[model samples]
Target: MRARLMIRYILGEMIPTFFMGVIVFILILLTFQALRLTDYILIHGVKVISVVEMMGFLSTSFLPILFPMSLLFAVVLTYGRLSADAEIVAFRSIGLGMPSIIAPALILSILIGILSLQTSFHIAPWGNRQFELLVTKLGSEKPATIVKEATFSEGFFDRVVYANKVNSKTGALEHVFVYDESTPDNPVTVIAREGRIIQEKTDLGNAASLRLSDGSIHRTSQGRHTKIDFSTYDVSLLDPAEQQFRSKTPPSLTIEELKARMKTKGLKKDERLSLEI
Candidate 1:
């Protein structure tokens, strides 16, 4: 019967894909988790607990990306295997047209797409919020939570920033380096005899600044150059946003919620209606 074949197709496409997705998700999560160790340990005083917590948090955030990828891989691999096995030929021999063969797969794809849309809108927003809160809590407890200077570093608000050397002894940012080569911002070298944290609360976002002192400022911008002999300066860390954050769970929400987002923009009524037709 048509119904049985459709059911078979849906199961064939989705199940193996789900397992592959989990494997890919774990691998990606571990890769990022490993990198966090260098910077986290540098600041948190290397500990087993820190590693476990970091891994846990990162994996929570990787689910959304994995779902769509898994669905794609599932459809491709399943159909490929069927074709190679001459299943398509068998179907054709029984009067199965292309549409007939694709019916179940298409239905399954639509279902997965609906799930993905929900994850991105509602579930992802909450997940991202938790991620930000976790990072904030960890950052307050361990300054190294925000310290990402293991390699050529880029800040949330900055394009280029680096730490030539971070003093493990005093928790001081020494040989501290930063280059905002983006033409609009200053191009400068910041040498902090020592740097420490100073937190400030703001209406728009949570803010923290690195207090850099005993440092001179060298700045160049937009066909102008200046050198300022200064005693102190502070670099601000911008606040995290709700929409930009993603959750760790591959959760689902309804289509009504998703359609409220910009992703649904193309689906809405247009001013140029009937013009193309």
Candidate 2:
């Protein structure tokens, strides 16, 4: 009963300190993170709420690293205070073993380590993927804002668009040029006298459409070029970043997925070894 009481006493002192340390560490990290995120928001004219949401996602991803450091700080602070108060000497005088003194910390460390492993391998990766999806959604929602006058905009998938003049308020473009490379072997280019952007809600999601007037489409394949003129044309815009987010690498896979992958065939020996490690 006395041993259990001693362990409980140690934990009672340590738990509050551990939480305080976690708060301090997270604040310090956010201070540096806010500087960069603020700069990005200002330069890109992004919404403040979006930035805040992004920060929350990033903070979630950092829990694995923060948990261990916070626990260490709590251990050091708690033991240092006890040492200063001569508690160690008093405990030794009572014939209590060093293992008994250290047992509580050891058990807590193991528990925290297990939790950290779950966070690092599963939660962190999920947060990272969510962050990428948020970026893609933000960019896709404002396709016109991403384009600039007299600049080659590569925001659209497999296409580059340029406008000699742009009216930001009206989402209108003058003297536009677009190079489309949707097909690897064949390419198309379009030149238009005027154009406008249209954002529409579709079943899949938000979609961007560019409507061009008095444009000529030029298609080239196998060293042959065909040209056609049209009174007006409309093309859909796709966000390439969405594709990248969808095809994340192994680091984004959860612990369960990794185990399943290990059982699958056609994995290289090195790949299986790396996963095992």
Candidate 3:
């Protein structure tokens, strides 16, 4: 009965500390991402709700790393406190050995280890993939969200966008310039008096269209230059989300998928070693 009580007491002390440690570690980790998240909200014009959802998904990926560290912190701090308070001596006097005193912590560690394994192998990968998909969707659906006033923005695939003035509320641009290098053989420079970003849905997916009024397209090919003037022109942007989805990394793969990839023939030595690790 005393052993059971001691075990319960030790667990009671450790569990709360474990949660506190996890919270502290999470906050520390989030501090690193806070700047990037702020840019997502302020510069990329992402919704607050979407940012919160991103944080939730990111937290899941942090769990596997946080769990073991928190458990260890809890065990160390709880034992230190118990030792300082003479609880260890008292338990020893009652015929409890060192193993009995440490058994609760060991059992908790085992349970936490099981949970860590589940998160590391399954949950974290799913969370990482979801986070990546969300980012890609955001970039694809509204490429102009990344365009900043008085700065050259290269988030658009194979193009650089610049605007002297931008209307945040309506995404209207003044004195816009774009350099399109999607066709390496024929580079084009577009200068527009006024423009706005338009999101269009096609059979392919969401596409960004830059609607320019009173603009001229300067194209150069084989040392020849040509200028085309238009009252209104629409420039369609290529969505990179499909390409991003195709390049899945190891962290985004489950253990079974990783194993399968490792077995695939003709993998480079480094790639196979990475998967094995």
TM-scores for all predictions: 0.56, 0.66, 0.71
RMSD of each: 8.4, 5.9, 5.8
Q: In model 2, where is the ten-residue run with the lowest total lDDT?
A: 238-247
lDDT per residue as tens, model 2, 1-277: 6667778988888889988987888778888888767754764567899998888888778888899999999899988988999987787787777898998899889988998998988998788778767766766676666677899988454479899998866779999999987665788899999999877766667767789999899998899999999999998765343445465546667888888888989877877887777
What is the TM-score (0 to 1) of candidate 1?
Answer: 0.56
* Cα lDDT computed for each candidate against the true fold: 0.59, 0.81, 0.87
- Backbone clash pairs for candidate 3 read none
Position 270, candidate 2: lDDT: 72
Ranking of all predicted structures according to TM-score, beginning with the best and ending with the worst: 3, 2, 1
Task: Report the lDDT tens digits of candidate 1 across residue range 125-175.
Answer: 555556555555445444433545445655334435455555534446655
What C-alpha root-mean-square deviation, in Å, does candidate 2 show against the real structure? 5.9
Candidate 2: lDDT over CA atoms?
0.81
lDDT of 2 at 18: 88
